[model samples]
Target chain A: MLTVKHLAKSYNGTKKSLTDVSFSVSPGEVTVIIGPSGAGKTTILRSINQLIRDDDGEILFDDVDMRQLNRRQLRDARSHIGMIFQNYNLIEPLTALENVLHGCLGTKSNLAGMFSLYRNSEKTEALQLLQKVGLGDFAYQQCRNLSGGQKQRVGIARALMQHPKIILCDEPIASLDPKSTTVVMDLLRDLATNDGISVLINLHQVDIARTYADHVIGINNGQVVFDDRTAALTDTAVTDIYRKTTSSERSLVYEG
Target chain B: MIKPENQVSLPTQLPAGPRFTIPLRFRDRRRVTMLITLLILGYVTLITLPTMIPDHFKLVEAITGFTENIKIMFLQPHLSNTSWLSLLGGLGQSILLAFLTTLIGSVLAFFLALASTRRFAPTALVLGIQSFMAVIRAIPTVLWVLIYSVVFGLGANAAVIGITFHSVAYLTKVYADSMDELSPEAIETLQAMGLKRPAIICQALIPYLKPSYLSWTFIRFEINFADAVAIGAAAGAGGIGYQLFMSSSFYFDFHEVGVMVYLILAFAVVLEIISYRLRSSNTAQH
Candidate 1:
């Protein structure tokens, strides 16, 4: 389980990205965060894993405060938390398998990773994750050669390589095509069901949020406006959450 | 005047400033500056040239040392050394010195560069390491070599020490710049997956810097070839430079001197070609 309390982050000292924002993730729940741009959705997820330090907050992962953890302890804790990026941040020079092996950082010694002398046990595990993401055949291919959707699949597999308790996805499908977008969303959905892993995904699409998320949390202007089951969000409330200020106030998306 | 393309293009009228005050002369400044500099240099040389005539006169005796007819101005026709070991042995020593020094200095500079980069290290440590690197690079390699030669005593090792010291300075600068421009997103991706600083530095940064590093090392070897020539001149050490200096001092041996000059140029050109190949392959691999 993961808990974030009073989390606040700001690039400039004056402005707060997240103001007293709090959230918790159960062991097997998939929590989808929806927000307009600059609404501090990504910041909230990054802050939880201490990738970006929160100005004032406490993040507890597996009953240990993440902020209080030293470098090694933090690294250890981070291994249980995997993060995915919209850009598919795979190391370009490495093959897909090697890039996935990068997720074993907390589990491996500093010397082992530095020398790349560690056994292919983690590598084999990474390949299995790749197979789960449907990249089973392209393990040895360079990441640069992978298409956008394939790269994200690799990114997802890389995150999974950590055997993480939770996964953080920051617009993982924003830059993807429609088909690929559906694929990634479905994959995340399956990950939750099959592995019993918690996920915090940041997305802007209301329909996608409604379709894939178990529960949806909406943020507008850096504050959460909606927190409830996905089925309970009405058309009017969804528009309000999205801040689509149409003079006609017509629904932007058709709901069948 | 340009109705079609200009009208359709985005509006980008030049902003008024000191950036280009002279509109007609704004193509480039280098041409005009280079002309002025050359004129000034030429005039200075003309004025001070009489004082240098005596030095050229000394070369006349060195030129006349060859007994053969064509060898007078053509330089030494043969690599005739006073001692076979000194010539062959010195050639071997020169190569060995250049090779060893390049290896040592390049390795040391590489690690130091990695340590000093902000991207690869924490800011506090990077700043201190960066300043020290700058200080080392500030002093010319010749001075470092000269001082090191004095301290370490006059031998090939001293020359190597000097070469490595200077190599560290330049290698550090180049490696630091490369490391700074290393793909941050790439490194972060690795880190996000739980990779450490060293892993990212090696897998991501080191490979990117490889061609540049190898090119730099080859360049240093070429420089140190001439540098080794000059080093022996300073310390009366073992090298072709000592032979040239001593040979020219007693009797004018333009033939042997030409041989020395030719040898240096030949080796340097070969190394330069190899460096070019390295840069090309570096691009290919990456």
Candidate 2:
């Protein structure tokens, strides 16, 4: 389980990108954050891994504060927290299996890592993970040669290689076509439902979020407006969560 | 039917052309034409200025003499003083010098390039290394060789050290530039997965940089070979270049010089073929 409390960030110290954002993700559940562009969905996900250090926050993963950890501790903490990107982010020149094996880099010795001395066990696991994601045949193929859907699947296998407790996906399907989006979303959903891994996703497609998410967190202008079960996210609630915020409404929120 | 207020009404007889044209800001057609014309004029003036021959110079006789020398050199090239085996040995020495320098320089440059990249090192360190390298690169490789010749006393040692030093600076700049072209997202993904800097470099940077590194190092190797030949006579390094220098300047053996020139050209052609083979094979693997 993970809990983020009072997370705030500002680029220029003037305009807040995220304001008092608070949310929690449960184990074995697909939690999707939905918002329009620049609504701070990405900021929140990046902040969870401490990738973009936030101005103020308490990110408690199993009651350990992620923000308070030192360099070594943060790396150790991050080893258990997998992240996926919209771009797939696999080293294109490396083979698919190699990219998957890279998932365990946090657990390897520096010398071993430099020489890429993956053990037989680790290599087997990587190949298996690729197989699980339906990329067993393309294990030795370069990632650049993979299609978008296949690449995202490879990325998923990579995250799984970490044996992570939770996976944070930042618009993983943004660049994907409709069919690839379905395949990737189904894969993430399967990870949550069957594998019991926590899945936290930032999504722009409301319909996809509604289909896959067990819980939904709706953000508007850096503020969390809706946080509840998917069944509770009625049409009206969805509309209200996505409604444009005016200056007066912003001022009202600021006052409150 | 009423048109929407947001929609503008069009004239029944529309204008045939645009009324106001957007002018070119900095490089209009006329300005480009004028600039090119000025460059041509400058080039013509430079060439014509060099044609101010001395009043009594026998231009025809000099041309004929030059042609005669060329004919003898090309048509009757044969080693008179230097044996073929010695020339081959000299070429081999020069090649070994180049190979040694390139290997040493590329290894040193790899580490320095990592430090110079902003992703791996601190901003101050990156900037410092980059600026220092720029200073090193500003001076030509030959000058560096001569400068080291002062310290090492003008021999193969000086040539090797000097060439390697300049090669390091040159390769570092290029390697760092190639490293900079890697997508930050790829690095961030690795970092987010808890990979350390070294692991990220090995797993991410190295694979991406392999092709570029190979090509750049090979290019530097070629340059080092050429520099080795030049410094053989200049720094007393003793290679084929020294033999050519002796034959042409001291003995006035144009045929021997021609033999050396052809040997160098053949070697250069072989190097080019090897480079092409390497580049194509590397691309094919990828």
Candidate 3:
């Protein structure tokens, strides 16, 4: 479970990138945030982890405020939170399994992690996740050599390695192919449903959000305009968030 | 087909205009400026020559005598030859100083460069510090070494500090520029993945910078090595430059000076080749 209360962020003497927006997700729930470009969707996710400092707000993760935590405390608090990206930000020089192993690094002793003192259990778990992601044979392969789809899958497995209570995906499938897009979306959905991980994903694809999310939150210009159960939204209801622009380009963002 | 009428006749065509002709008729301002500058230089030299020096007749005679004596001396190689070991021995301290200082300066400069980079800087204050490093670089290494030779009590230690300080400035600029070239997308991706700042630099930025960094270091090393001689001589300390200085001051001990110059040039060339090879091998391996 996660709660963001009246969150606001202004980056470096500039206009607020995020306004007093609020949203919450229940345990094992897939909460999707859909917005046009520059809607502060990514900022919201980053703020929850305190990667981006919010000027005003409280992010309660299991009822503990993350914004108030100090450096070491924040680092420790981060183990329960896993984040992925569109770019599949694995250390390129590292192998697939070695990168997945990086997820456990926060909880493992820093000394042990630095010298690569991985436990047999952690290695087994990493290999198992790779298998679950259909990447068992590519464990030894360097991340740089992987295709976009495979890399995102490895990104998921790497996130899953944390055994996180909450997972944040900032357009994890935006750069992927249609087939790979569905596979990744389905995996996120399955994780939220089966693994009981609270997930908040930002996406441009309205159809994928509707197909996979348990709930949808629409954000526009740093504000959350709509939040509802995914099942409750009719086709017309979805249009209000995407109806401002008439160009084919605007429709492509949430065309379906 | 029997009449060969089916065979396609080559069509007459106007050739594409002037594919390889030089535009000789056109003259740009650049060419005009160059010609004017050359003419002025030639005119000034012609006017100044023969009158600039006092007693040209005696001067020419003296030069001729010096040349003949030098020629005779060179012909007898066994007479005034400086031993190879002594020449190299005098150069050792300067080379050692350059090596030590470059090692220290560059290592620190890398961190300084990282801190200075807009991408990695903790704050604006850090960026300001990187600029100050540029001021250090603007001053020549020889000048800095000369100053430090006095401030640091005039020796190879002074030479080392001076070289290190200057090398740091040069290297920081290189490092920072390379850091700037890193993809903002890559950095954002790393940060999004919850990696720490240090990890982001080590993981994403370092790999991209490795080739350029290695190349820059080798190039800088070669430069610094030559500078060692210059700074070494100037710093009131002993080096190949000091030996060269001594030989020159002693009046045309070409045999001794020649050997030292040859040795320095040879070592420098050898170092350059080794570094070039190392960089090539490193890139291939990675």
Candidate 4:
């Protein structure tokens, strides 16, 4: 389980990007955060992994405060937490299987990592993960050759190789086609239901979020406007979340 | 006029056009001034050219003398002091010197680049190393060889050290720039995966930068070859360049010099072909 409390952030001491944001994600469930563009949805997801350090906040994951950990401890903590990006941030020059093997880089020694000395079991496991993501044939293909959907699937396999307790996805399907969107979403849903891993996603598509998310958190102007079960997010609630800022309200600074 | 079914109604009143305080004609005055200054400089240089020549210099006679030398050099090319086999050996020595310098330089540059790139090191360290490299790069490679010769006493050792020093600085800047071109997203992904710095560099950075590194190192090799040839004569480091120097100056053999020039040209063309192949293969992979 992941719990964020009183999350506050300001870039370069300018206007606030996130204001006292707090939320909890339960295991065995898909929690989707829906917001308008520049609503700090990316900020919230990145904060959980401490990718961009939050100014003031308590990010507690499995009773360990993520913010308080030292460099080494933070790395150890991060190894169990998987992250997926909209761009499918696999090393484009590497083969799919080689990229998947990189998931265990944090666990390897410096010398072993430098030499790329992966054991037979690790290679087999990476191949199996690729198969699981329906990319068994593309395991040896360079990621730059893969289509957008295939690349995202490769990313999913890479995250799974971490054996993550919670997977944080920031707009994973934003660049994907409709067919690929359904495929990626269904895979994330399966990971939650079958694997019992907590999946937290930031999305712009309300209908898709409604379809896959067990719990929905609606954000407006960096604050959580609605946090409830998916069934409780009515049409009006989504409208409130995505409402455009008026000319006067627009003067209030916001960073995308 | 009937509206298209899908077309929306246009706005009744469009906003005003963007306003500027300065007049349009005066806005580009700075450019006009720069052009005028360049024209004046050109006129001055053209007027002063003849006056700058020495009193003893005779243009027609000098041209005739130069053509005579060129005619003898190209039309009657032959080895005088050194045999053909020895010339080949000298060429081999220069090639080896260039290859050895490039190898050592690239290896050292790779590590220094890792430290100089912004994503890896602190701001202070990055700035320090970059500025230091800038100073090293500012000095000419031949000048560096001369400087090192003062200590190493003008031999292959001094030439190697000087050439390698310059190569490292040059490669470091190019390598770092190539490293900078890497997608920040990839680095973030690796860091988020809890991969330490060394692992990140080895697993992700190295593989991504491999093609670029190869191309840049080959470019440096070409440069080092030219530098080695130059320093061979300048620093008393024996190579085909020294042979060319000895034949042309001491023995006054223009034919031997012409032969050496042709040999160098052949080798240069071969290097260019190899470099082209490397570039095409790299792009194909991409």
Return the lDDT, model 4, position B182. 88
Would you give the TM-score of chain B in model 1?
0.73
Kindly report which residue stretches of model 1 are placed more than 4 angstroms away from their true locations once superposed. A244-256, B1-76, B82-89, B120-125, B244-251
Tens digits of per-residue lDDT for model 3, B1-286: 3578777778788687887779777879998999999999999999999687676468778899988757644554331445667666766765676677778877987998888887867668566876788788788988888788677887777778888888898888888888888778666654444556666566567766787888888778877888888865676667778777777676557666656666787788888798879888867745
Candidate 1 CAPRI classification by DockQ: acceptable
- Indicate which candidate wins on DockQ: 4
| Residue range B102-182, candidate 4, lDDT tens digits | 999999999999999988889898899999999999999999999999999988999999999999999999999998898
Model 2 alpha-carbon drift over 4 Å, by segment:
A251-256, B1-56, B281-286
RMSD of 2: 6.9
Q: What CAPRI class is candidate 2?
A: medium
Error of 3 at B89 (Å): 5.4
Which whole-number lDDT from 0 to 100 does residue A150 have in model 3?
Answer: 93
lDDT value, residue A95 of candidate 4: 96
> What tens digits encode model 1's per-residue C-alpha lDDT throughout B17-96?
77845767655789989999999999999999988777547665656643453564254345555665576566666777
lDDT of each: 0.77, 0.92, 0.80, 0.92
True contacts kept of 4: 0.75
| Candidate 1 colliding pairs | B62-B252, B75-B255, B76-B255, B76-B256
Clash list (residue pairs), candidate 3: none
* DockQ, all models: 0.36, 0.55, 0.16, 0.57
* Minimal lDDT window, size 10, model 3 chain B: B72-81
lDDT of candidate 3 over A71-120, digit per residue (tens):
77787778668888888877776789988887776666546554667889
Error of 2 at A127 (Å): 1.1
Off by over 4 Å in 4: A245-256, B1-60
